[model samples]
Target: MRILICHNRYRQRGGENLIVDSEKAMLSERGVEVIEYVRDNNEIDGYGLVKKAMLYFTTTWSKEAEREIRELCRKYKPDVAHFHNTLPLISPSAYYACKEERVTIVQTLHNYRFLCPGALLLREGGICEECIEGDFRPALRHRCYRASYIQTRAVVRMLKKHRQMGTYEKMIDLYIALTEFVRTKFIEGGIPPEKIVVKPNFLRNPPDPKYGGDYAVYVGRLSPEKGVDVLLNAWKKIKRFQLKVVGDGPQRAQLESMRVENVEFVGAVPQEDVYSFILGARFVLFPSVWYETFGTVMIEAFACGKPVVASNLGSMAEIVKDKETGFLFTAGDPDDLAARVKLLIDDPTLAIELGRNARAEFDAKYTAEKSYERLMGIYASVIREKETV
Candidate 1:
């Protein structure tokens, strides 16, 4: 089968970008013909002020992107097209182009851009779902995007324009939500439940399961939304258990100033090195405050047979079975987080048992083989439905 995957690459690469590459590699290994049409956000940097000013309008509908997709579809004649992220660059206009070329559209809900303009249901250091009520004006009023009213206004305009044009409702054939938590949220935001499917991100090249190590590890962005400060505060109370943080972000300076004991800020290691840290950890810590779309590191930790102590919210709560595969604590609560850490450290037997369960879960649900099967079924179903219609 021929499948065309489209993505808008971010300026600062993250886990999502890595997932895109992994997915493409998996498809190619399965002998499927994969056609890519990727756009980069770096293009925005080269834009003049006048064009930047017009970005708000064009972000809603990009004729240039649409035309490019149309040309690619005509040439490749793929059975289906998949989209990852399409914000200001690719836009939802590409979906229209897919329809024009008789291509089945499959979009992955990587983040919460559809429900909230800031793309993370976060505002003023807390969860804010005002936009989920189907109104984005609050995002503008608070300047949620970049703390600038003008930028927030631009995002609001794009969101309003797309909802009016029925781009999400009419143009896209299927939506791949990364978790049940995310799927339910999308349904709440007015997406048809029938049009959405739950598929967690898979672990690529997972290591052999081996539990019990010297320290606990945290792997992700060190921003406020990630609850880094909460983590540092929690670590201050976590007695003997050493914490190693393996990421760098806007809050690095803030984190360094805290002087938390038994915490090592090993900023931004290579992906392979990050995996090594997971393999050598007693457990992984994911203290994100936002309703995470999915936990890429959680699955990786599971693959390495390491238990996770995650915030009891969103995908983290849903993914980590409390006291089964891992433990969960109250979101943004440092005291609760500290207690959970104590639970894992105090009982090495329990932690190892949890790690073993995590490995088993990864084998059952998150292997690349399983992901490939799920994707193939979704593609086939979409094609069959298209033929029937």
Candidate 2:
């Protein structure tokens, strides 16, 4: 089987980029031909003001991307064209290129970009669905993207144009959602229920399970949406265990200023260091305030035989069964988060039991072998459906 995978890489390396690379490698290892057409956001850094302005306007329909993709499709005659991120570089016009060439198109709904201009479905430190079923004016009014009205307007225009042209409704053959919670949200936004499928991200090589450690760890961006502030407040209440933050973001300086006792900010580290931190933790912390599309950290912790103490919201709630694989605290509530952590700290044996259960969960659902089987099934089903039509 041959697949054409296209993605617009973020300026900074992120989980989406990692997933795309991993999936491509996985398919190649399985004897499948995978061709990638990738664009990097770093290219924008070289543009002048006028060029940047032109780029924003053209984001609604990137003719250059369409031309390149059309050429590639004609040359390769791929069975499927799978897209991850498009945004300001490879626009929705690329979908039309695939459709015109008679290639099956599949899109992974990594975020709520199709439904909300902000793409995160979050505003002012809370969940905001003002534009999910409505129009994009609310997003324009709020300047949801980058806190700039012009940038937000550009994204809104792109979404509006695609909606009117039926690019999302008709061009795409299938939508891969990372979790059932995410799939449901896309359905609510406008996608047909039958066209969407749930496929969680997998660990290609999970580390061996370990039993016990001293500190608790948090392993994602230290941003407002991640609830890092809440984690700090929660840490203030706990005296028995130390907390180690494993990532960095815009909020790091402010977070460090608070100087919460017993909390160590281990800024951004290598992937190997991240695994080391997780392996040396009694439990992982994920106190996100927004509805995450999928909590990759939870599965990583489970793979390391460490249970998580996550916010009881969206995909986190769905993935981490409270009192089973890990414990869930009320979203954005520092006291509740502290209480949950206290439970594991007060009873080390309970933490061990939960870690064992967490590892069992990973073996059952999150390994590379299981993901490849499911991925192949999705691809084959889409190909067969295309043939019938």
In terms of TM-score, which candidate is strongest? 2
- Clashing pairs counted in every model: 0, 0
RMSD of 1: 1.1
Per-residue lDDT of model 2, residues 66-164, tens digit only: 999999999999999999999889999999999999999999988999999888899999999999985999999999998999999899989998898
Give the TM-score (vs. native) of candidate 1.
0.98
Model 2 CA deviation exceeding 4 Å by range: none
Give candidate 1's error at residue 224 in angstroms: 0.6
lDDT of each: 0.91, 0.92
Candidate 1 lDDT tens digits, 222-242: 888999899889988985778
Cα distance off (Å), candidate 2, residue 117: 1.0
Measured on C-alpha atoms, candidate 1 has an lDDT of: 0.91
